[model samples]
Target chain A: MFKRKLFHNAYGKTLPYLLLIPTFAVIILFIYWPAVSSFRMSLYKVSPFGNKTIYTGLSNFENLFKNPDYEKSAWFTLFYVSFTVIATIFLSFILALLLNQKVPGSRFYRTLIFSPYAVSPAISGTLWSFLLNPVVGHVNYFFMKAFNVQVLWLTTKPYALYALLFSSIWKALPFSIIFYIAALQNVSDELLESATIEGAGTLRKIWKIQFPLVSPITFYLVIMNIISSMFQSFAIIDVMTKGGPGGYTTTMMYRLFLDAFAYQKTGPASAQSVVMFLLMAGVTIVYFLFGERKVHYA
Target chain B: MMRRYKKPLVLAAEFVLLTAISLFFILPILWIVASALRPSGPLYTYANPLTLQTFFPTTVTFDNFVHIFKNLHFGRALLNSLLVAVATIAISVLICSMAGFGLAKFAFRGKNLFFFIVLITFMVPFESIVIPLFVLVKRLNIDNTYFALILPAAGNGLAIFLFRQFFSEVPTEILEAARIDGASWIRIFRKIILPLSIPAIVTVIVMVFMFQWNSLFWPLIATHSSRFEVVQVAITAHRSTEDTSWANLFSSAIAGSLPPVILFFFLQKYFVRGISGTGLKG
Candidate 1:
């Protein structure tokens, strides 16, 4: 009887494992297997027929680092990620705080603020490209009429990055605002009231009490912004500029696209991808190491 | 006495600032709509100013919409996107929810290892895996099929994680009672767990639907023919070729973006809850 009970108990405990098999199969087949293959491919050399898999012995990595285009792509990616994250966070924090107030039409305001989040990056990037068209764009038309300035928004060197940044921040701000609003709502009302009772001004209460409470959200937003800026902004660049005006906006992922698909340098592309993965993983690890301790849950 | 006025003044300032910001966000969308309707001369002419005339074309018609469908094969692409998205949502939700249920409610050895594996996959960006995935897809001879787009995206980490987090919140006693009453595991899932988890299931469906609908890169690489092209790829093709009509291009873009926006607006409460609830945990 004891042995029978033991067998039944073991079967009961193992049932969940049976249920998880499909998910594990998917991960192994799609994610883990691909990741492992990519890593292995990075170690070899691939050719056009795709038949020649010569062992490169770290030559791909050496080639990747040696190429000046890689440096340019890296710099552009850094600039894009940092600018978008900072601007999106700053603007969304202010918007979240403002919308959190008991103002009339607040619901409408919240919806309007979040409206952009629903639009896909591809569509939004196309729309913004049209809007920022140097010759026919409404933005330039208005500026030319008002200030008599026809700035080449997508062509000029430094301004090109700014245009991309503007488009990215516009797309990302609604998401950040939504997150911040949620985080702000979770802050204790008593904390804010006590700050007020201590003779604190609005700015003081926000700085001393509210900002600290929302730091975790801010950190998460930063990480998301970085990831999105790295991987997803390729669409924006593809649509808006095609990494154009002499490759001024050729981000790392875009360059990876060029190398693998356009240039047919599959081996180097795989190598670059591994490097990009390590960079992103390193950043995320650092973020978690420092930020995890500071995240306070109520 | 002065403090009362200060409050109203601050509120007025906030109102003004917020309205201006909202206008900034809304103007581009409004311009897209306006440009789509504007007449021939103003549509292509740089010098022509945006005016009340621009807002309403002199000959107001559905020329843009009709032209996109008639000229650009956008109808086919839209249909393809709808098929892929719906299939993705159905398959993903079912598979992920089952996995999530297992992870959340069941006590099994190696559970933490499996959960960590899911998390690692979640963190690894698709860009890292796209090449190998392409090679795999090619080897399997599934390239250019709808399966190329749907299958890889169906078992994503985000949906699994979202469902698991939600399933964990469900009470265990209910499942226990169902089991005691001689209900099978699959039966408990269907009758007890699923019925109680409709909110989360809807949330996963919407979220996964959005992701699949907007997906571009994988489809761009995987699919070879225009017939197999999703809406996003169609848009990119329209932009790249330049021979395609601008009115048609803009109209297709507008149409492609409308479904999600409308769905989100109608089901915004659930959408917002899903985002906030999932985002906080992440």
Candidate 2:
């Protein structure tokens, strides 16, 4: 094997290691070290500034479990992650199926729909907040013109979470659409044609052929949306709702952010991150075991 | 193309569905651009009535854009973000591609172990680790510096994966021939490998640039000074204050988002390929 490596006899004994050092150094310092530190810090009540610490053991976790806010955050995070995963997969699959129809102007539609993936969350939040503003906003303006009533999208309780849901789904649709479109395109023309020859209707063909072929991507997207909702929702919550009316939209990650950064409660924050890291790992493991088995090469 | 004969009505319905979905994606972007272009005023003036002018400024002005770059130091923020992204790309591309080449070509000690590390890191969401990373960054006394902002994200495991996949396909014959001709491995890499790896390099560049440009959380914690404020953080500033500056907010968000959008338009193919390449096989 060494003889058949890039150089005969594998002459460059140290070159590969040298090439790998920078990459390994970075992950060790930034990823692995921090991960281990997060596990460590959860056991100690570190001061906000990191200038003080006490060995508090599992008390921080006990406090986290006891905190009403943490409970609320966990509930919302569950709701948010579930809704986002299901909705994005369903909606973007529709968009992708439509785009895959070879519709006239499909290219134009594809370009516009997939453009949002390029948008930053900060900008997305700003635009959504502006559009969903209770007064003098287009959404309300149209609602008022059509229905004669105004809804407080940002300032109200249930509406704020729903508003976030809308914006986040809007932001996420393009990404999933891109993936689904790719997956749909990968489904073979021969199988589709055979289905057509067998008198299968579009819906029948989609349900039978397209759906199974794209299941892997759907599963992949489910994992992605969950990870995104769990950890990457800071800007959206920050700009649009500020986790607000009360803490209605605060996911556990946002709760952790607030505790660690805003409130200086480092121990509970570390515990929250530990939970997040495990949740993400668990989801990815499920994807590997289940979703990987569902892959259809054709 | 799998073009099947369908009723024109069905075709029309598909067209309508496609167009409606496209509008949902386009209108918000148009709203931001239009509202930013409108002459500075209270947002209600332009937004209240659903007229044609709601999405198209009656009097187009660059003043909002100018005002941000001039007064708000958005130019500096743009520079900072660009610097950080470029610095990251520069460092990331070299290291990841090197690791990619190394792993692709070498049957070395701990190869599988290193590959496992890369896979694990790639599988882990970077955002989930930010708090811990912040702790590490603070501990190292690099908090609130460029080092903190750029260092953590500089070595991307996915980019290495992409490069490894790409490099594996490259034939070993050329390198062996070059070695026989007295070419140093580094020289062979520069001459043979780098030139042949443009597509992989482009993919990594796009990947790194997008991540760096769009990141808000790490940058939020890693740096605090106004001087180090990135475009996303600067955009957040537009809304954080009690008196949210809608004009500046709209303007800076538009300006800040342009770089990645432009990259998407120009390198559309790579962007799509990068998406498809992420873990799941498309």
Candidate 3:
């Protein structure tokens, strides 16, 4: 009887482990293994024909710092991340407040604002590229007609980065709006009513009450914006500019692409990826450390 | 009465602002549709292009859509994308649901460790691992296959995490009653748990399907030829060396985006619920 009891207990314990097999296998084979391999590949030099592999200790990192293109890409990446995060969070907060107001047809407005989140980046990029085309774009025509200014949106080096930012923000804003809407809905109606009764005006109510209530969502949005700005913006850059008229908009990931696939410098590309990974991971960790304490669920 | 007047003014201002924002969002989409229908001759006119003449098609035609299918292999790309996306959803949902059930219901040793692994993976960006993943795929002889796309995406941490949260909220009494009735663990899961978990399951399916369908970079890297190219790649390949047929390209793009748009319209209630529910819990 004791033996049977022991057998049943052992079987029950093993069931969960059995269920976890598929997930563990996938993570091990794909995520964990590749992560290790990336670090290992950072230690070697790769050749064009994919034939040569020479062991290089820390040389790839040294080369990465020395390269001028790397510096430009790094600066561009930082600027892109900061600009997108700030603009997205600020705009989303305002939209959220507007949508939360007890106005007629507010539901329609909420849905319309969130609609852009459904469009894929590929479609968004295609549409924007068409709209911003210098020759026949409606945007160029409008600018010429209205402002009497013709800016070479994609072809010009100075203006190309802004075009990229414009397209990204247009695609990204809807998601931020959705996040803010969710956050805004959870704010206490009683608190707002009390604030109004206390003679607090609109801006002051927002500053004193709604802002603190949604501060956690703001923190979450900032972290997500940084991650996406770094990793996911490559698609827009790829489709719209192909990293440029002359690599003027070449981001770090774009440059990493050129290094690995185009130039066949796998070692340095791996090093660049590692640096990006570390930088993003550092940001996330810091955000969690300082930001988590301020995030109130209720 | 004065407060009532203030409310109408607020409502009118809100209406105007929303209309402007919606126009800004939808204008490009409208242009894509108009450009797709415009006669090929009128597409390249450089001046005064915003007039009603260019706003609507002179003669409606399906030539661009037809050309995309014939010249760009839109049919094959659609099939490839559908297969990859469906396969990813099936594999990920199965693995994640099982893992989630185990994590939620069972009190096993090292459960916290497993949960931590999932959390860490969630935080790590795919770009950080793409290089090594490329090498791994090539080494495994799976570089050009659908498996390359499907398997990696199937093991998504977010799906598992979301499922775990949802499952944990289910009442334990239901499962205990099933156990007392001599139902095996698998039987209980199939009959009692899964039936009750339909809402969560639908949420995961829609989210995973969208993510897989829109994925670009990994597919760009993993697959080489047009045979394996997905819809995004197909539209991209339509841009030729000398001149791009913007009409046909945008048309194909609009067509490619149609599935998710339609899916959203149908499943939006569940989608919103799932997002808000899991979002707050996280």
Provide the TM-score for each candidate, comma-separated: 0.89, 0.88, 0.88
lDDT tens digits, residues A109-164, model 2?
88989877778887888788878877777899888989998999998979998999
State the lDDT of candidate 3 residue by residue for A217-261, as single tens digits.
Answer: 687678768777787787788778888878888888788877776
Over the stretch B125-242, how does candidate 3's per-residue lDDT look in tens digits?
A: 5766887788888999999998988988888777887788677767777777778898898898899878777767777888788888888878999999777899877877666768
The lDDT of each candidate is 0.78, 0.81, 0.78
Query: Candidate 3 — what's its lDDT?
Result: 0.78
What is the per-residue lDDT of model 1 for residues B1-282, given as tens digits with 9 covering 90 to 100?
Answer: 112233778889989988998888876766566656654333556325867554444665677777778877888988999999999888888888898888787766777788878766656668768888988988988988998988888787767877786777667777777777889888988998788777677778777778888888889889989888888888766665546456656667777878887877777666556545543442
| Chain A alone, TM-score per model | 0.91, 0.90, 0.90
Whose lDDT is greatest here? 2
Which sequence of candidate numbers ranks them by lDDT, best first?
Answer: 2, 1, 3
Angstrom error of the Cα, residue B272, model 1: value is 1.5
Which window of 10 residues has the lowest lDDT sum in candidate 3 chain B?
Answer: B273-282
The alpha-carbon lDDT assigned to residue B251 of candidate 3 equals 81
TM-score of the A chain in candidate 3? 0.90
> Residue B21 lDDT in model 2?
80
Show pairs that collide, candidate 1. Answer: none
Where model 2 places Cα greater than 4 Å from the true spot, the runs are A1-16, A47-50, A296-298, B1-6, B102-109, B122-145, B165-199, B274-282
